[model samples]
Target: MKLNVKKFENQLLQRLRDLKISNKKVLLAVSTGVDSMVLLSGMLKLSKVLDVEINVAYIDHQLREQSKEETKFIKEFCFARNIPLYVYRWEKEEHPVQSIEAAAREVRYNFFEKVLKENNIEYLVTAHHGDDQAETFLMKLIRGGNIQQLQAIQSVRIFREDYQIVRPMLIFNKKEIYDYAKQLGIKYYEDETNKSDDYQRNRLRHHIIPVLKAENPEFLKHVLEYTQQLTNNLQAIQEVADVKLNKISKEETLDYNKFVKESPLWQRILLERYLEVKGLEIKETQVQQILAMLNDEKKPQAKFDLNEKFEFYHEYLKIGIRIKSTTSLNLEENFELKLNQWHNLEEGKKIGLFKINEIELMPGDETLVVEDNENWVIRHRQPGDSLKMSFGNQKIKKVFIDKKIPSEQRNKSWLITKNKNEVYWILETKKTDLSLAPQNAKIHYILVFRKK
Candidate 1:
């Protein structure tokens, strides 16, 4: 088959232009395969027409003995053409191998990121064509992925704030790439592992794609078209979801009530977007666990441990980094509180005793009058300390459980007391009539807590 090198070159150049990477320095991930070789050829030709700097990057997994010969061939090819080449070899023995494909991909991309940063390259180029996209779609579908995951591969993906990965040949199919390489007489090495069915992708490529292509000659073309449509639709949905998410999301917490009212699809999209913003990639089970926690009316005060780095709680669906309370103040040590002065209680927290006549009360602010001339001490909950309520004396731990305070917060919560015999007020919530001011007291003192 005759290859349209000019047409291919124009299409690739147009893709790079569309992605706004036409004149940027791009590092090509070349594996000496037909697809990569064709990509490299097109990029080399494009360099002649445009002011784009193209560099080749190759990673040898070292799984097969033939990789050494392939590396030698790639080096010789790049040397003859005077193309800059960066080669990385996998230290198989140094790293423990588990899940060969996943491990290789992780290592390969890490190397790519390092090369991109060290070389000041903005774009890392790869030769993932339409067939790869189709195969990925099928794989995700069989693996129970959602709509977003089904449209996984994009033409251009922002790898980091300053770097991106671009696939310029996704418009072409595998057959077109192979024919282009053959017609141009490009030297390339075929990986023997690709023919084996050890990997799911290999199975799909060898068995499923061939059967589907035989049934419909333009199967890959149709799949690519559908993927494009799906991508557009998902983008539109995400825009709407973002608007909803922004409405309920604050600096530290998301309003659970508003989030729960959204449609199930919007809820999933919003939650996924939230996690993505936090740089977390959660599994479907974990997403479901979060949704379950949100929807559980019986356990509205539940907390989900997302990972070691973060925790999700149901108090307005607060998602934040896991923080353990370091300051555990024991009430055994009594500390005096002076009137009209603020005292540091813990990090970002303080308490003050003020004359009620000097300050106005806000709607949400809690105030308690000083009962007698005795000195008040600020301390955390002790074993015997309980809040004096309308019904009876309730244990501090029970009060915390009733108020649905998270355990981590309960540990650091403070209490106000005139003596060990009675508890006057809890820092944020509970209060007793013991400190309530008389109907017409001449002087009133107020206990207040402030958080920075």
Candidate 2:
């Protein structure tokens, strides 16, 4: 297929302008492969025109014999053009036994992020073209997922706070990229694994895509259009869902009273949004199960486990999510307490300790005046741990029994401590008498605990 070079360049320029990437140093994630090399060539050509600085990042996975040669080629290419290039090698020892693809992706992105942060670059560009987008949509559709999953291979997305990932090649297809590379006499490596049908994506790319393309020459174009439309519609729906979810959500709980009154569609959306906010991935079957449990009047107090890590419960007028507890506690594990930073004690629980120069005490706030910052740590309850009382130290075990705390709850309780066998606070349950005292000292240190 002959690619329209002028049209491709115009689209690429417009995409960058649309992303507002002018006068910025953008990092190109290149693998010395056809698509990425084409992107590198195009970006280098436009760098002067757009007033942009181009930097290249390459990851040598070291899985194939050509890996070293590819790395060398990328270095020589950048050197000849006097462009900056960053390269990272995936050492053989670091590779996992299974799920290597997911692991490689994670490693690749981590390297990209590190390079971006260290160099103070705000834009990371990649070469994900229209054909890849279509393939992703088909894979997700075949595997079965929510609408969000079907809106695949976004052209632009936030990589992190204040940093964006831009894909300028999404308007082009693989054939166009290959054609462009050939026209420019670009030298690139072919990953042998891509031709293998062992992977699902490879199977689809090898068999399904070509058949569809032959059946309808515009298959890629139509699929891209459908993806964009789905994304647009989902964005509109998400806006409404976000507003309603904000009104009804408090931390991890949704006001059951307000939630039930929403239309059934809105109710499902709200539930889905809640799960999304909690970073939990649920299947359609699981969503239906949860909806059924929530709508059951007889089971006002019921719990549903989405997976091993998380579960949600309904109690009268509120729905709450919590981390599922393990069969046994590992009390020996301890986390360090750092001032002015939030320490995650466990899933859904964190504590922040801060030191302030001037102190205005909120009546019920937890404050402690410390002479020195040392030895503070957070850990699960240990056997024979005690809290000092006016007369003597009392065993935490006795306190739990006296307070009628469930055995499971007692096992999961986290405590703040500075010394062995002494508990300062039993986090959200018991506070040391010291923590309750007013901030009358010269300096005030406040400790705040949050459960989400």
Candidate 3:
């Protein structure tokens, strides 16, 4: 089939327009392959019409003897066109067992990311066409991947916080890519490894995809549509999950009862999102295992080790890193309770005492009044510290036990006192309304805690 250069150029322009990359610096990942060469050719043509700046990058995997020659050819090609070219050579590492394809991809991307940061490149472009997407989908599907994974390649994806990877040629098929390259008279070296059936993708491309295409010439088009639909559905489901999760999530815990009441599919989704926010990863089986632990009636207060770094307590579904207790505040020797100012506490926590009239108090925040001549000190709990509660005078140790504050945390907990006789405020736990002020008290203090 003859390539319609005008049609291909129009398509390329439309894709770039949709990506909103008209004036952006794009680093194109090019191999001496037909797909990449055609992409380079198309971009060169678009450069005349658009304001986009393009640079080429090539990674020599060092797996083939001809890789050196292919790298030289790409360097010369870019030089002839007056385009900047970056070349990275892979360094092999000794591992007991490794997938060469996966290892090569990791090394190539690490280099690309480093270059992007060094040069302030906004977009990393690759020539992943429709056939590559289909092969990826089929491989992940056969390997029992979830819906999101089955969708495979995306047109544009965030590579880092502000950088993106774009596949503008994903709208084209392999045959169209070859035709376009041929029509432009672009020279590209073929990778013999691509034709070898040692890799699963190669086996699919050489053996399975042809038979499927023979049965239905438009099989790939349908697959692309199906994957798009799956992507849309996954996005919608994620939106709903996010809304529900936000409603029941707290700073350090998930509402266990509400999370358990959700449907199984939503439970999985919510857990996945929660873990993602925590910067943790859990497999499907681990998710199920956690749910089972939550549902187990015999162990109402069970604790599960998520990994070396984290632990999950069942009753409240609190997931947090298992960190050592902070050292004692040692307030007896060094610290004093300063009024009307914030004090820096251990562990990025801050405490402030203000007059109730000085700041509007939120609900659940405690307020109190103190005598003018009273002296106060901020200190960690002592052996016999007691707080005057609504019920009566209660030992601070009893309060910690009743609230189920971890033993490690209790050792580091802070307390405020007007005298050595009574504890008035326990930071982050509760404050005692010690009605010890004069009838017309002139000084009121509000103790507040905040994270830095």
Q: Which candidate is the best by TM-score?
A: 1
How would you encode candidate 1's per-residue C-alpha lDDT over 404-432 as one tens digit per residue? 77766776677787765578788886788
Better of 1 and 3 by TM-score: 1
Candidate 2 residue spans exceeding 4 A from truth = 327-452
TM-score of each: 0.79, 0.73, 0.71
**Backbone steric clashes in candidate 2, count:** 0
The lDDT for every candidate, in the order shown, is 0.80, 0.83, 0.78
Off by over 4 Å in 1: 1-6, 283-289, 296-300, 316-345, 348-408, 417-421, 428-452
Model 3's C-alpha root-mean-square deviation from the true structure amounts to 7.3
Question: Evaluated with lDDT, which candidate comes out highest?
Answer: 2
Clashing pairs in 3: none
10 residues in a row with least lDDT, candidate 3? 316-325
Candidate 1 colliding pairs:
none
